[model samples]
Target: MPTSTSTSTSTSTSTALLRLRRQLLSTAYGNMDFRYQLLASLADRALAELDRHSSPEAEELADSHLRPEYIGITEGRALSEAGSLGIDTSGWEERRERIRSYTRGADAVTPDGTPADSAQRLWASLFDNYPSVAAALADLLTGLPPSWRMDLFQTNDLTQVPAEPRQQGDNGPETAPYSSTDWEDCAACMEANDLCRFHSGFLAGEQHLRGLLATLATDSIALEQLQDRNHEIGQRQARESAEKSPERETSQ
Candidate 1:
């Protein structure tokens, strides 16, 4: 049998790996937002300088400020961060370059007809061509804490989803029953298995993820898809509940 110390170390390694994946995804998402804001800031400076002086020197300075290399630098930093986590981003270079090219071309636009930032444009393209990636992004963002939520980029560009009431109980509101099970399992695992060191607050953290997912449902299609998934889960739960209480159903 494995010693308790070895089991704990194994659990710790597993937990670290899980957290690293989440961190990498969050960093990627946040980097796009950061890149957009950085570009916008440069543009704002260029505009202010342009207004102050119409000289060739001022124009050159403004143009230099918005150069693609600056964007590349920001993305490079993001890549480095991911690499540190053992994520092989070498293959991702092509996608990153495509994003840079699109942003440079000045064609991406938000749904409201405003200029879309690098991240927003990148997200839209990913949604169309690589929806699984986009879905993973949504899943990653949904779990971030409010204070930790990426704010450098504009979320307003996403289709605004009004906060909907979660399925409620007579007391006021309730989370899915599975959430409770997961929460309990997390706790029990941590207690019974020396190797399982999952966070005690993992359940609470899930709320943040859910809120982020709702925010990302930026279109009718996405919203419908999410709703459909939720409906399916609800149906499954209802069936399970019925099976477990067939006597109650018969009495009623």
Candidate 2:
């Protein structure tokens, strides 16, 4: 069997993700951002698929995760597997039973378990609390170019997308020189122009570029917010530790 290497999405959301990954990876030292985008992309794909169609079995699988106790375990596993890779699913299969309960709506009102507040909740717990989530992100980002860390908050650059224009003429007013023979009475000068690679005008859309910029601004702001909160989490944890254990308290 031949090994395959390709990256493409079956849907527009996938396309957006592909572009996002490319944009972030275009910069230097971008591992965290790259991993985050990749994880988000994967989550988007799953959510899209779920919203479209699912087997009863799959529905059961989704429901199995809602128990307060199991919510922590299953959602954690889901995040680690996706953003972190499958590195932390040691107890994943077992957690699914609880998730199934949630999917079946068994825990809707009881509110005993740490059921997923939303899919975002799953990501937060896994990345912030689950040991594997950050590890997975770290691994996924390993050895990648710094440029891959693009977000709406930073620059979103473009790479060449291969393309060629089809022409109906050879030597006539519109034909590329390759088709000069097909043009019948077309001029040789026109044919030569068509054959010259330099003469080919590359195509891109101004509106598309504008849209990309807008998205970049949005992403950048979000990224900065994340960074701020992450910094705060460390401080918050330190403060809590000081309050909980007097021995650990700082002079401040």
Candidate 3:
């Protein structure tokens, strides 16, 4: 038998969870600007939650669970992780630093003392520098997994899967050294790989947050149970003390 208050709280939590899920799904398939906006929003939400439930244990859980993913998305660690998978992420750190400058307000002033690039301009710059970002995202829906791609992307025709990796000295122009198409393909694949890593980190953080929320919810219940047990022990001890006092009075 749940109280009205408890039911309301549960409904509120469910609503928040649904909203977070929708944000994550949109971020997954969104354009660069939309993705960046949602990521920033989600990060702020996580920080707000931490502030709302401030505790040493909560801070520790956030550091262990949420911080890594947040850093990965904001600081280009996802690209670095992809690099560890043998993907070439050359200049990724530099590009990430450029984005960071805008985020940190370092790029907020121009030479003429005018306000610098807006969010849209910054995103446009990123798009120009990394033309394959959108393509890589599209690849995720239309290239990687075959059966679900069509249903998800709503295309009657299947996208042609990329050919197998080329071996050195293979009898094809694609195997030629310094092929521009090869470079583009590599860039697209790396970007896609980075995105996948980012999504994995996001999911991991979400799981941690869910666990932390559950623990916070139970903390008051556990405290109430302990208090009740202690009260019962105190009452029992008082009864025993009174019973013994009567005997002492008779002896006296």
Backbone steric clashes in candidate 3, count: 0
Residues 1-252 of candidate 2 have per-residue lDDT tens digits of: 111112123233434333433443443234322334455556545644543453333234344543355545556556666656546556556666644432343223121222232222333324433557657866876857676635422454422322234344221122222232333222222222222222222112544767777776789886677679999999999998878786545433
| Selected candidate, larger TM-score, 2 vs 3 | 3
Clashing pairs in 1: 142-209, 143-209, 159-218
Model 3: per-residue Cα lDDT over 1-252, one tens digit each: 334433443345334433443455566556343345566567646644653454333334444544345534644567667878998778776866654542344234222222122333333434545457645655664665656746655664443543446433221111111222342323222222122233434546877989867875789986677679999999999999999998999999
Query: By TM-score, highest first, what's the ranking?
Result: 3, 1, 2
- Kindly give the stretch of ten consecutive residues in candidate 2 with the minimal lDDT sum: 1-10
Residue-level lDDT for 146 in candidate 3:
54
lDDT of 1: 0.47
For candidate 2, the per-residue lDDT at 35 reads 32
Per-model TM against the reference: 0.18, 0.18, 0.21
RMSD of each: 25.2, 31.6, 24.3
List candidate 3 segments past 4 Å from native.
1-19, 25-76, 94-252
What lDDT score goes with residue 158 in model 1?
A: 45
